[model samples]
Target: MAGGHIEGWSPESLEYLDACPVCGARTGQELLYHGLRDKFQVNTPGAWDFYRCGACGSGYYNPRPTPESVGRLYEAYYTHAHTAPLEYAQLSLLGKLRRILGNGYRNYRFGMHERPASILGILAVWLMPDQRALLDTGGRHLPKQPKGRLLDVGCGNGDFLLFAQRAGWEAIGVEPDPKAVEVARARGLTVHLGTLETLHEAPESFQGITMNHVIEHVHHPRATLEHCYRLLKRGGWLWIETPNLDAQGHARYGENWIGLDTPRHLVVFTDRSLLRLLEEVGFARIERLPYCPLCERVYGMSRALAIGASPHQSPPLPREERVLARQAEANARRRPEIREFIMVRAWKG
Candidate 1:
């Protein structure tokens, strides 16, 4: 899907990649997914050629920008032009409707449409159930009564922090976006403005730490994790949520998939790669759960739309469309597990 016209000249700001995130042997380059030039990526054709690393199962955009130059890709074009609203609006709607519909309906139902979740929030649930369950879970298997502090990396508008606060946890958000931090702060959320790398304040400080979908955007994941390790209390949890190439949508969309919003996504993850990462950085009790249904539906529909196959593409409806629609509806009714998340809990041991 990444094979577009590739127009924009993303200045060649390449830098040496530190040792392989995995293997650490410096020889980790294998192309696992080759993309076909689709209408989705019909841009410069000269910009970025994307590929996957076979050694570690990570997807990346080649001719990649240096960490600093990455800001070049975050312009309005990248923000508004690249984002799809229907999906997120749908999620926000579901979240508001949680009352009439109820939340725990899933703990009992097998495959009903999942109550909508911010991908980041859902990933938070999967990675730190003990944290998320404080609200959703009726206290079974919950971590000892919540206490201490929590840092929401890339905390966005502080929705998750507010949720945490409701659950009796001391929560604060660390967001680099001033506008976002302002919004969260308006909601009375405690937000710090700065990157975690520059924050020289703690060692084993937090009870839990989370970086939701923001790790891929950072310039230094290794350096970032080093801080996460320092900020967490012993036997604490580090929840970092990045896209999982192992999901079915990546297979369906190939490159043009918005999930792989190249240059922007920067570093995509797979189960093995994340586990390897956690261990290398001294995290333990790592768990990987890929809730495929949610990612598949959101990313799949976006990919479909990109390729003129979605209902939004103005393409005429087909007989198969009816069947596919029925299947989607039925599947939604079945409440198939949709999210794919990696939960890594580290004990001071």
Candidate 2:
């Protein structure tokens, strides 16, 4: 760990940008954050710098890790282990109950009311219609039938694919992480080990595409969305979710905000910035969904970690330590624009 550099990020591993990757705006750029570390990969060296575009108001890394060296940054990434493929046979009684609730909640979220085949699902959905949002497994806004193929970009370990499959959607995924792809394939999922650029196929081949928390990591946001538009069928849906730069957590935690994962999260977007990117790519019928609670959890967890608190840190955090997270979530409720992340659903024209 000498010089604070990660092992595989060779000295030759960084690409400097001359213009905004989103809007291609070269001038009117302002420095946003500097000396931001890869706190997720605490071993990574050399602080990262980010700049904001005055034209589009999007924030991005100035010197991002090159394609060759970026893989090293994700080595031993926690998501691979924590989000392990769903283990059905090993479910405890409570786990089984959660599954039932999750299934019912999924249906409720999508405006479907199919009679649940199981009694558990019936009771769960019937007894607690208001809790549908919390119980949902999160493939919201999907059609009821498996009409066509759906592509999930950066579909790490294919957890969402599994959920989509259960909901009757044909699921395919492309992931650059080989280890994660392995886990996905073991579950009988049709997952390829590479980025979307590796897909050599006709345009309009997919019925829908999703990139949850993935777009910000992309080197070129506009190019990625254009590719998405090309791959999707006419009128097909595209769901893109990413961290919001306007969140109060950024103001409170500064560099320690978990959303600003430094070099990894290259482009952070606000609602307006994200809308512009999608619309500029010819997407139509754009709609904004409710804020993701995971964003609040990120701030809470990051705060705990910052104070050296254990993962099992007892609830009811100290008043002083908890103020920032509470205020951020309150802001999220009051101002949707300030939500920690934005999930946009749009259709390809």
Candidate 3:
């Protein structure tokens, strides 16, 4: 799994960088992981190298896939799956109750007027903090705006767009993958088939822009942030969720950490590095959002990788591993930096 040319890729398809893509510091870079392969997909050939930037505390891949060849890695990506939304009529009695309660809470918190919702959902959601947090995340923690347009960048299959549209925002998406775009369009979503730079909308056209697990995949993250800043209206917000390089999972699992995601995730950011980048890009009032309940899934996937098990196969996690994952998640509430993912919300001044 190390030191071989990737299948269907030539030497020129890779690009080597001498400096940190985040801070442009070359001297303090340290090799974090060497000969990392596509453990999850097991589709891409050849091993890759990951390095940490001492200056900014970010992680990145060197001799990474160039923009031209990178598309090959996503040919069988998860975004291509067009999962149909669950219908209310298909739910069991308890399932329908939970849905109604969840919808009720969403209406109360996010101003959505979902049918079959009851005010009791607020109390029910409050009783279950994890469910409340999940609802907040599903809404992107956005407060009720004046029904302005929301842009979802790298919007895989337009899942969030549908949610935002139902929540009363004029939701649109930008997706680069043709298969993903086609799937989203099939769902009657408005999606542009290109990157953010290729979007023909006027500057400051959106009231809010969201990028979920999308920033790390881009070739130029700084430029991407700058573009997002320009695309948002004055006083608008940008929400970003990406794998944290300084995560506790990375510390525990090392190269087997799912966040390493070789070749696909070109750059991984620590909280400090990401906050600095947002400020540098002219974003004001930048704030770190609370971590969600994803430790079990992240740890489970990392554990599967450690045991040479493909996560896509849905390997069963042992009871001990689940307990440890829960412990890690509880610990993250006190030590937020140890969270598996970095969630950030920044505002355009």
Candidate 4:
């Protein structure tokens, strides 16, 4: 970062970030990223080095800013929740639910080129077959979504919350980004301006929680998960999504895999290592969902764009590749992948 800190950065200011977040144990050198903070690149600037506990595999962001420093970065750039209204809430939840329940979006249901594939993709996600039988999703095992008091940590623009809201659950979000918070609030949802470590929780309170793509950014993933465990009611579900380290994406692009957005996405998880971390942390009933083509597309494009294309622009996929994505979504729905990966689901039993 300048071999120097930013406006609010101070030496020893955020030294705590370097240790294993989940276990509070000292860690060793882990994966490092250089383009995370490059404004003009796919990722931003700052050389990011993540640390992992040899004992528990709990990872942390070392030489990383303390929670407060992370707070400042988030405050400056993220305002989705407070931004001008995007009418996001108006249709997302019901739209998603209809896809979940059946029928599809009211306005776009009849016909559209993308609609069929999108509908197929949606059906594939919500109704994937497990061992030949359809699997129940969204943790519907609960009685009435349970007023679950769900928390979407780093709930970007509250996209997930929009659905949780329509499901009639009490959903609250905690995001370090003010811009995202602004946009979420603009959608009529309440969100807090802060990071997970800075959040104040009423112990043993929530029925279920989700950390979609948020785990990788925390300095201490284990500690963060533990905090989540403590906050949940016994047997509560904690659904989390993050990039898989073992994927071909990293092999194909090395440090440039848009997935490795350093400084921000500090820790990466693989199925094997992730399982060990979960078991060590007290989670059970773990499962890995198949990966979507979006993972490769997004990361590859980000990497390609980082060198030349606009950072905000998504990398273009060939027409044939796009068609393949649709087919993958459809087939994966009917049969889950044996290799390609996605989200990891577990229970805090």
RMSD (Å) per prediction: 8.5, 4.2, 2.1, 7.2
Clashing pairs in 3: none
- Candidate 3 lDDT by residue in tens digits, 1-349: 1134655568889888888999998788898887788886786887888889999999998878888788888989999887775799999999899889988999988888898888999999999888888889878887676779999999989889988988899999999999999999999999999899999999989999999999999989999999999999999999999999988899889999988887799999998899999999999799887557989889988998999987766487789888888899889888767789989899998
Candidates' C-alpha lDDT:
0.56, 0.74, 0.88, 0.58
Deviating ranges (above 4 Å) for candidate 3:
1-8
- Candidate 4 deviation (Cα RMSD): 7.2
Each prediction's TM-score versus the true structure: 0.67, 0.85, 0.95, 0.68
* Model 1: CA > 4 A from native: 1-25, 31-46, 75-144, 289-292, 308-348
Give the alpha carbon lDDT tens digit for every residue of 103-151 in model 4.
Answer: 2321122221222124444454345444112222333222343466888
Clashes counted in candidate 2 amount to: 1
Best by TM-score: 3
Residue 7 lDDT in candidate 2? 36
lDDT of each residue in 8-121, candidate 2, tens digit only: 455678777778888888899888876677666667776777888899888888777877778877777654653453565678878766765665556645444433324466
Mark the 10 consecutive residues where model 3 has the least summed lDDT: 1-10
Task: Write candidate 1's Cα lDDT for 287-314 as tens digits.
Answer: 5432223443444455565655632343
Cα deviation at 148, candidate 1, in Å, is 2.1
